[model samples]
Target chain A: MSDGRDVRACLGVCDDAADDPQHRCHPQHVGLRRVGARPGGDRTRGRAGRLLQASGRVVGGVSVSIDQRLVELGIELPTTPAPAGAYVPAVVSGNLVFTAGQLPFVGGVLPATGKVGEGDGLVDPAEAKAFAATAALNALAAIEAELGSLDRVTRVVKVNGFVASDPSFVGQPGVINGASEFLHDVFGEIGVHARAAVGVAVLPLDSPVEVELVVEFE
Target chain B: MSDGRDVRACLGVCDDAADDPQHRCHPQHVGLRRVGARPGGDRTRGRAGRLLQASGRVVGGVSVSIDQRLVELGIELPTTPAPAGAYVPAVVSGNLVFTAGQLPFVGGVLPATGKVGEGDGLVDPAEAKAFAATAALNALAAIEAELGSLDRVTRVVKVNGFVASDPSFVGQPGVINGASEFLHDVFGEIGVHARAAVGVAVLPLDSPVEVELVVEFE
Candidate 1:
């Protein structure tokens, strides 16, 4: 079944699906068959699908898959971080999922601290950008926790990045690019979204950067 | 048609359907009728709805009307403000609408500038709160521009309030209350939403506060 290989290839599952009975007839493969059987049925044509295809990693005329791209990029989604406060991490209303402001925490601890652009003694802008990416990953984890799959997302609508900066520092946008670039790397064009990068006085837990998202999902 | 009245009341629209033929039937009214006709149909019963009803303006066991409440409070929505940059004021995706960050520009100019809590000689926190309310109003105007009517909104899912704060300020939540309270006053329970109050170092045009919204609509 060449189509089955295409499915496995797209999802970055096991290449030995044909050899392994368990992988050969997975439910997602069954669903893919149903989707592919229909005429003019391009699974990657929708907003979210279009985004995944933007990576230009197509195989056998099929669009590149998010899972496969992640694997190729050597990226792994981190565990959903626990909330540090009384609030839930994300809320879904209608078809939209809103993530709370997320800090850059790994294994339940902050990787870095202090304001961005404080120069001699504080967090560097480059390091702060990485923190923004980590915070964004936490946001994506929150969305996955709420929706069960990142595949359900149609578009990354907005990204609001807050940077704690020294009064003289004005590179908030450059720091926030960490999150925006990471999103684009994963979702491609559909990941391109409106954004606001603002310099903040301070952040919760004294984080150098915080990121939040508004996503539209099917 | 008490059911119609219930829907109208819940949406805060006018009751003079006959006097104003155009007001007699809106598409949202029809949708609400379908929702209200369902068993245990509480149109304003979710998280956002619960907050709108907290105002306790019930009539005939239905929530008091948003339109009437605005009249009672002498609040009128301001005109939609032009964007200060290249971005559109709002974008509609499926059943969701996302508004760009809005400044407190009344009649095309900011009433106040500088950081919140910069007191001694700058803007007061209290005045900054009012500015937040005005910024929220601008966001609502953007929503109206996209949907043609505020009644189309089913829930205010999220509100992101950014305060340009002095290093010493810690009352970010209290200051953002201006936008939250104003939304509650206008949309009632439907206006209640998950919110993030952030302290930023500066805002576009050096405005004191900026507000953005994510709304779900019929």
Candidate 2:
């Protein structure tokens, strides 16, 4: 059941819970680095020693650069998805960027369809949750496309998640938590955001979930 | 069919179109006073002549104060609805405020409860549009409660509209126009915003529409 998604919301403190399904991250670091450093943190074997790179250092407890954080997590962001219709994938006004609703488009195709629920002709909630994380990752792709880089973002302000449901299903929050927690894992404290999760009848392209983001950048 | 809703999105330039079924507002005023001011704008009956009050007036061709525009449109912001769960109705950071998803609750009750679509046992798209407008207005009430005055708003930055649908409905954008046109009617050019409208399976309290807003203020 492990998605192989790491759990750095608490840094290395919860390394054991990273693969355990029972533990979920809700970081209280508030965009600050963990002051009580663990000294010997998990080091990537082939990151070219990026931990000591100029942009990845710890200073005054500010969080690490998001680019470096992505490297540390062993994740490579995918290409920015193209808007399917009249709208652009994302728009920047002032310091915030607003993204269009994004489906879980992995390599240009939604991974699954149908309402999320138990039983026949339905998508499992666990699968939908994973899709939500992928959808949030796509939103970051859109933001990067608009602002030229992910390093400009200062906060993940809000995530609006919609889960297509079978009407009787009421686990919308649990499904959306996948996106919320993924942000926390990436941005540390700055990833903590206000969110709204809801169930909807259907979505464009019949994708199981749709996600949109409002991000604040410098 | 008129719904007694005004068409001040054009600043009274379309008074007859207010009740005409053929015309819908797509104001281009951009929150500016129509420079070619139509000779006489509509006057209010009991706004205590608020148009000439200290806070309302023309300035460098920006736009009339939102309060003055609301009086001109004959709308009273409804009482802010209580959040249905553990979240507050709105939160602010920096110069912007983000509102929670708001259901079209009139007097603490949903006027209709069903997926929006044609045929039997569905919520009509037209009715759903009006509900979207009401939900956006409710979001404003939450903003007013948090900021003490809607007058602080400088711009309606973005709107995220969710229309509960029957899985076959594709009128989500038309439904959301109900809220969009209403905001334009009240805030002039500043009301224009980037928006994302999506059809979902259902909504909380079985609401046909749920709307949320991101607003920028002075």
Candidate 3:
């Protein structure tokens, strides 16, 4: 049933329903709308299109406003962080925004360093989990800067969590839960996403945790 | 310019242009079409939408079909490999398809093992490059299984290359080029993508190289 015409038609239906506050188009339609909304001449248009198109599916029945949820949780997105390398902090392709791997930096400096699950003189997994949350916040900040507001986001598509770990560390998923939990708290159901938690030899700047996000925006 | 009305208008334009062989809609619109074309209520719709959306950004003006390129290169997609863990080989959400980390397994067995940059007794970096390519092929096989054909794909959005490296190894990017080069040869410009080359402490199954893909398809 997947063919070009059907998707377009579905999106058209979604467009017609746009005025109704309770109307929920499919996530794919929302993604298509996001992609089509951007100016076509922008160099980032292609990338934005590709990202958003893939993120078209929206979980139905979620009416909670993301902004209100953040406020309820007393969360404030931080200022966007400067890139640690030559890359831009995030790029909008089609309907999706992909962020660079963010380090657990608080105000331009890493709060802690070394491998997770290591003994003394290294980062504890618990601490690394908190760091992961910080890194996720940084990623959200980058998204906010790119899209002008977090409310534009439709879904958190994917999260790639890279944990620098001691040789024996096997709790990479647990460490990344810090970021996942925080996202869930902020976006509720829309914050739910696919993820990869990997243990790495080291990370840039020796940071214990790094987090990146693929977010779908409306 | 990225507002719901603008996006809807853009997609409408794309739908009107669909019958023209040379017509190219904005990537997001194309992605939306792909997602909408899929049969509704299919369990994989969301995943399919996610995978296909990121792939909407086709390299415009390249007339060579992906199938033609594969034939020119004498490439044959191998059988889909079974996942080694609890995860499925690939998952489609929205218009995007994501593959689990794929190992260089031939007939369900790894061709080589050990770290990428280690001395003798371990897989050589050069050999690991080849393994990376093999792993990439496995990822493609999974995509093909999910989408039924590689032709449905529009772009290779992002590739994450994980190399199990010796402590002193520093050529992770070079090693991953094996997979990148092979993908480019097969998909040409559409295969060009953002990538991360990482050095890891170890990988599942002790394989020298592991590759995962985030692909967009129609």
- The number of the candidate with the highest TM-score is 2
Steric clash pairs (candidate 1):
A199-B201, A200-B200, A200-B201, B12-B66, B12-B67, B48-B189, B51-B189, B52-B188, B52-B189, B53-B189
Residues B1-218 of candidate 3: C-alpha lDDT, one tens digit per residue: 22323333343344433223245656544212211111121224243333332232343434555666455445567777644321235656678987766778776778876777757666787677778878888888878877988888877889999888788887887677778656754664466567898788866545788888999888
Better of 2 and 3 by lDDT: 2
Interface DockQ of each model: 0.12, 0.10, 0.07
Candidate 2 lDDT over A1-218, as tens digits, reads: 11012222323443223222223233221111211011133433322232122123243467567777776655567787777789898999888899999998888988899898768999998788778878988898899888888888777777888888888665665676567656655665455455667897778889899989888888
Candidate closest to the true structure, highest lDDT: 2
Candidate 1 DockQ vs. native: 0.12
Fraction of native Cα contacts reproduced by each candidate: 0.20, 0.16, 0.08
Question: lDDT tens digits, residues A37-112, model 3?
Answer: 1112122434333333322332244455556544544556667788988999999998889999999777788988
Query: Which sections of candidate 1 miss by over 4 Å?
Result: A1-96, A105-113, A154-160, A167-206, B1-52, B55-63, B72-74, B78-102, B105-111, B141-148, B167-173, B194-206
User: How would the docking of model 2 be graded?
Assistant: incorrect
Instruction: Return the lDDT, model 1, position B180.
Output: 64
What TM-scores result for chain A when each predicted structure is judged separately against the true chain A?
A: 0.72, 0.74, 0.70
lDDT of 3 at A192: 47
Cα lDDT tens digits for candidate 2, B101-187:
888887777889888888899999878877888898889887887688888887789999988888788778778877876775566
